[model samples]
Target: MNTIEVKNLNFYYGNFQALKDIGIAFQEKIITALIGPSGCGKSTLLRCLNRMNDLIEGVKISGEVDFKDKNIYSKNIDVVELRRHVGMVFQRPNPFPLSVFDNVVYGLKVHGVTQAFRLEEIVERSLKATGLWDEMKDKLNSIATELPLEQQQRLCMARLVAIEPEVILMDEPCSALDPIATAKIEELMFELKKKYTIVIVTHNMQQAARVSDCCGFMLLGELIEFGTTSKIFTSPDNQKTQDYITGRFG
Candidate 1:
């Protein structure tokens, strides 16, 4: 089933239109990758899924981004609560300058989950879910920023999972990691998709192909094509998608 749907979505940064009449549906408990060259609005559309664009001044958006059958752009929506259900992991590992335990419990603390036992339970479960518990259990008190790049990235994912979000948005989540680390994160993505609906904006076509069940190709602020990853990679109906996939042009 579809967890989120974008219909005729448009976005503008001041006078420049960033997303143009986009439409796509993200399925539940699966990985959906949006791939494109830089500045093609892939990130913009990712931000729109949880109203992250609202933070920017002079930005305008129209059309519907429906999460669980309700339009997220509707005036009645609570953006903070919306964000809780649709969490985001940025392009870089952005673990706060805090201890690993603190980072894992940060969102829960924000939402007023103060019971020590509950917090500990969540921390353990979240870290285990991201395959970090064995490595991090002894180091919960260690400063998060002091960890290796891969661990930090996994910690960031742990932080998000702690909040129990229904959908996770990852913006080039493995861009900063080495090949081995990237492979680990891709494996984690497979495990994560068994629980949360995942939407990733990736510049790496190969990464998208490896991790996503479905893929969308965007260019010049438009979604040129979207389909099953196998079809998009091997037999895309659109020439633009075929060209982009074949590296003829990006």
Candidate 2:
């Protein structure tokens, strides 16, 4: 059931250690929420799964992050292929300045898929999967930025789905949206877990409680506790986790 595993992981942004000896295994096709205060390596650890930290200058990572039995950090590993298996969605809705149709199909195009009918099928399915198809079905060729911000975020999800990744990583995905938009996205997150193993970082404790089956709490670059959401919120083994969940301290 462990689809992704990390062991003895350590990461540094030029000697400033961001994560320290972090290890956890994610169950397949379930929602796992990573929660903690800001700058606790929640997002940094999320990025490490798929090697996004490689983009930062002077960054060095030392870890064994295995996805489907392969060490993602191995020298023979292909980052592009690794990313294709593990897709990430950012905090903001960053749809490119192109038609909605193009935005979703862009990934397919990059991988040398150019058949018009097949591309259209993927675009429709991706949009539908994110619940954007009914709304944007009639305006496929219109500029993507013209849509409401909520729809735009869903479009970003559609863009991620177009590639058919096995895992989806969301970093504070609903932080920028209003409560209503956030609720919709939360619902979408619930729906998405049936198909993909989702790892989400959230500032909203309630959101994490509602959506995630399992939860991990991190602090000061260390994993404090990880368990079922019910146990983590109600009766955590770690004092830090209890304090955090109760709002006594963060």
Top model by lDDT, which number? 1
Evaluated at residue 201, the lDDT of candidate 1 is 94
Cα lDDT tens digits for candidate 1, 1-250 = 9999999999999999999999999999999999999999999999999988888999998899999999999999999999999999988899999999999999999999999999999999999999999999999999999999999999999999999999999999999999999999999999999889999999999999999999999998999999999999999999989898899986
Query: TM-score for each prediction?
Result: 0.99, 0.98
**Cα TM-score of candidate 2:** 0.98
Best by TM-score: 1
| Count of backbone collisions in candidate 2 | 0
User: Worst 10-residue stretch by lDDT in candidate 2?
Assistant: 54-63
- Model 2 sits at a Cα RMSD from the real structure of 0.8
**After superposing candidate 2, which stretches have Cα over 4 Å from the reference?**
none
Please give the range of 10 consecutive residues that has the lowest summed lDDT in model 1: 241-250
